[model samples]
Target: MSGETPLRVAFIGCGNIATRQHGPAFQTIPGVTIVAGCDLLPERAQAFTARFGGRPYTDLTTMLAAEQPDIVVVCTREDQHVEPTLAALEAGAHVLCEKIMAHTLAGGQAMLMAARRTSRLLGINYNYRFFPPLVTLKRLLTEGALGEIAFLSVTAHAFCFHHALDLLRWLGGEVVALTGQVSVAADPQVHYPVRCPDFVYVPSRAASVVVRFASGALGTLTATRYEHLTTRLLRLEVAGARGRLVVDGLTLDDIVGRLTRWPEGQEIPTGAGPERGFALSFQQADRAFVARVRGAETPAATGEDGYAVLLLERALVLAQTTGRTIALPSLTPVAEVGR
Candidate 1:
């Protein structure tokens, strides 16, 4: 928290994300130290600690008790998020959870409640919000560069549907209602690369959702894993009464091929270079979380935001199943939803 004392950080799941993004990003921060890494497999934990400089442990309870970390980064699989997050909060540590908050609404709600009960910050890694071009777009929207957003459309990979949902809420406004449709993989042999067979839930390979925002803005999100090209891993276009903005190409390493404004036919500089790539967004996200933990006012997705996205995911699924529009009350408490 102070310049003299480095914040002791620990990782709960030292798998792919921790190894690639979180570990590397934290290493670049000034006043943070990786104290421990915990994983179900000792070899994985050891491998993570070897590169990131931490003690390795196979048990989370043992690591939490021994290390007493200031912050816990939950990089576990989707279904595994809630348990470690709640545990970390109970152990008196703030948490930075990986996305898709949890596999279910109740799980997300439990994690949210735990954070409130412990009075510790619970930030979700909605890293796309930190993409420089998107950051500028948010600033422009706030300044009313586009007067009153009217419509938004997002195209993303099926794996990024949650990110698309988060973007809709972030760039547009609160969603009031939504309808959705999905195309499930017909072949039993076809499974998403990252999701394990034992995982509680696996998202569809392609899906579409239409939403009505509280600002009266209508939006559509279409996501599919069938696309072989990387040109539009994630693309967002927003239109307002005054003008329109388009941000194309949001991939892991290459992001924002172009950011352009309509009518004026002007190209906007994103101020992001190809060298850093989209991975810089993860660093930005990690830096914001660290700043918040140090008692600074920073913009990062909160537990409530994560819960709201999960709620929308649930609504979308319900809409697809029932073939009906789901109305979400803006004022409703997350805990009270789907009860």
Candidate 2:
């Protein structure tokens, strides 16, 4: 899109993610201009705009009408995602929403419907897919370098449950059946140096889910909030008929301290180190969304993808409650299942 008119971008919910990830990311992109920042708190909006080169607004409608942005980035909390995203699409802008999509499947469905009605691009920021090591691993799998997948395993802190779930579906084929169980901390004396706010913390301290994929591959995901070490926040391992791939030590500022491949005995180094790698993932994701908006071919997670993950979440909960294997329905023509 060189020499083309720069894409005007606005942001809703100028919080930590907006300030730390999206704002910095757009600044590095070539054909994007930050036009406005909107937040309920006037100071937050003002502060975000001051640093990101955008005007500030306290209301979404006013921001939409005034800026008429080509893209709206929804950085609000998970529950507040639908309203701003729908408004942005309806007001004639593509939308890139933060993760979790929404608090409920109904809300996610509404956002998807609005995007469909408006015919505007709707992207979800599943930034983990942009990690350099994971990106390389995906390419290897796509190229059949790792024959037929047999089993995949993921272990992470509870905070990464959603991301792990998305990875399972992305790397392993569509899920066919799943069962899950959750455990609470037995010792009431568990403490943290810094506690998350009530809204930020999910109550489940530990959980495990087993899933069977449509391709007959098996997968397991285990997450626990009980650990106090930062040596490794997330680890993913996939075994195939030919070989296996392992990615270890993913955190907010770091991803893939080590990436190992079997048989070949090769170790891939994820460049840029911890200080820059994880943040680079966000930049890469934003760049992909920008390329998609420019009518270029790029890989990005869509609204439908986010909705599918939510469906899996619902199925997992049901499985845990009923102590029965829950079968996941196909999400094709998501509009049909969205409702």
Candidate 3:
């Protein structure tokens, strides 16, 4: 086979996440070039450019005008995601935006609109779904190995409520009715910059949400603030008519009765190191975004997918506040997005 055409790529933010996850992983993906980078802080941008071999800019418009990259990676803060993403999409650049898609509902909607207005593919960097174990789970569901999914129980213990919300969509189809609550209970185990009542908040920080899927299946989502736990733990259980699948880290075991079944796990242990399982997940996500940018295939975390998760979260929040189950609304699933 012949070599593929190189794709010019720009880094829009030079923050810690951009440095750690995006930068290292982008290098491994083929057909990508770090042609330009932009940051509000010139020093940080310059430092990143020096390390990654890209021209640095303090503003996005300047970078877009100069580089005209095929893809723009938005790794800015949660509050700053929409504007730069919209600007990049409008400039005809495909975007891979960081998670927590946007800070507010309106901001999320605006970003959605911008992607629709332009034909450029927009994707959210939802790294968790790219996990090898999770990927296996999705395939199992699609292959009918899991039978009809009756219920999904997810236990997310950290600042990753979005992942839990996104998983609901990933596994249980669209949500029709949701009732939830976010509570504040004192715990000394976790530390974060964003503060809530009793250092806890609802939906995002710590919450119990019950999602009723359109197919009549039910899912229960719960996230808690553990006082003594330092490591992140995600426990997802999908119980169907046949059996239950429990996966933690690299091990995926199908439990029908007292025995484990099939390819039990990966060779490396789940919490072995920072460079193993989850690291591989991020690398997979980087490649997926790169593939989408190269016109190979749409990423698993498409703009429509991200917006759907946001809409579900918004509905869950309203349900928590109103003391009633909120019904899902009709949404525009057009690939284009704008604000």
Candidate 4:
């Protein structure tokens, strides 16, 4: 076993996310060897292997037995996450499964159980938690900078599963309960005919969710797909024991501490330098995975962490379905100071 050799990894999915986010970011991180690739689709596996330098395989079991990767990156669709993640854990490989966590509660539980049974690290790619500014804010929260942490307000839309899980995990603070409402608003103007074919229409959702954390902190998450442009608006207000702070346009996070204040109408400090791209957060997450593989660090979002997030997500969906608040399941707690 070449354990110390650049930690070998297999990419289980070769879709758009694997290409645009994970694949490109893997090229930037150190101590990573993307040794094998697999997908149900042979062409996608071949294409990914061609672009990223790996052996392409159609079956993950075969790939695992042959390549013997120390880590597996499961960037597959949310519905397809459980099987591969379970397989990898059973094979004694750590897994980084992309999020929502899974399509359903049962699927997510299976993955969690497999990880626990095998005692292998399982991480869900809740990448937004890695955003530099968010990390800084989390540190401040640990110091009780925000007076009482009265309420948390969030305004954003669907993030293709991966992005949504990150924000929920980061801001909610170990959710104890969830109540959600999903609404659809249709626009006749949204329907437009294509030049060569029939008509194409865009669909949108308006969701309002309320989450209560174990520490009594509350978060109100409102999502609507009616923005003028496709963008994310992440705003946090942590009212501490003495003062309050707000984080906006998180890309300029290096100057995070110098940002806005609470109670409104106060002069906000500005950060220097132009705000860069969102891709940086994804890169940070990939680097964290590599670091964990090398025993340099533990993953920010572990398999149990993934399970917790997925549990909350399931509760939210159930809340939406039954129009009632759902209680969070009991967690096998870990000892992480100031988390």
Give me the candidate number with maximum TM-score.
Answer: 1
**Candidate 1 TM-score over all chains jointly:** 0.92
Question: How well is each residue in 1-339 modelled by candidate 2, as lDDT tens digits?
Answer: 567558999999999999998999998888789999999999999999999998999989999999999999999887688889999999999999998888777777888888888899999998888877888778888899779999999998776778888889888878888888867676655422333221122324787889999999999999887644356567999999999999886766577566789878789765545454567888889999988898886767888888878777777777767899888763233658444
| Backbone clashes counted, model 3 | 14
Pick the winner on lDDT between candidates 1 and 3: 1
lDDT of each: 0.84, 0.82, 0.72, 0.67
Write the residue-wise lDDT of candidate 1 on 30-65 in tens digits: 889999999999999999999999899999999999
**What residue runs in model 3 are displaced by over 4 Å at the alpha carbon?**
185-205, 227-230, 250-277, 330-339
Q: Which scores better on lDDT, 1 or 4?
A: 1
Q: Which one is best on lDDT?
A: 1
- In candidate 2, stretches whose alpha carbon ends up further than 4 angstroms from where it belongs are 186-203, 269-275, 330-335
The CA root-mean-square deviation of candidate 3, after full C-alpha superposition on the true structure, stands at: 5.1
How are the candidates ranked when ordered by lDDT, highest leading?
Answer: 1, 2, 3, 4
> Which has the higher TM-score value, candidate number 2 or candidate number 3?
2
TM-score of 4: 0.81
Clashing pairs in 1: none
**What CA RMSD would candidate 2 show?**
3.5
Candidates 3 and 4, the one with greater TM-score: 3
Model 3: worst 10 consecutive residues (lDDT sum): 251-260
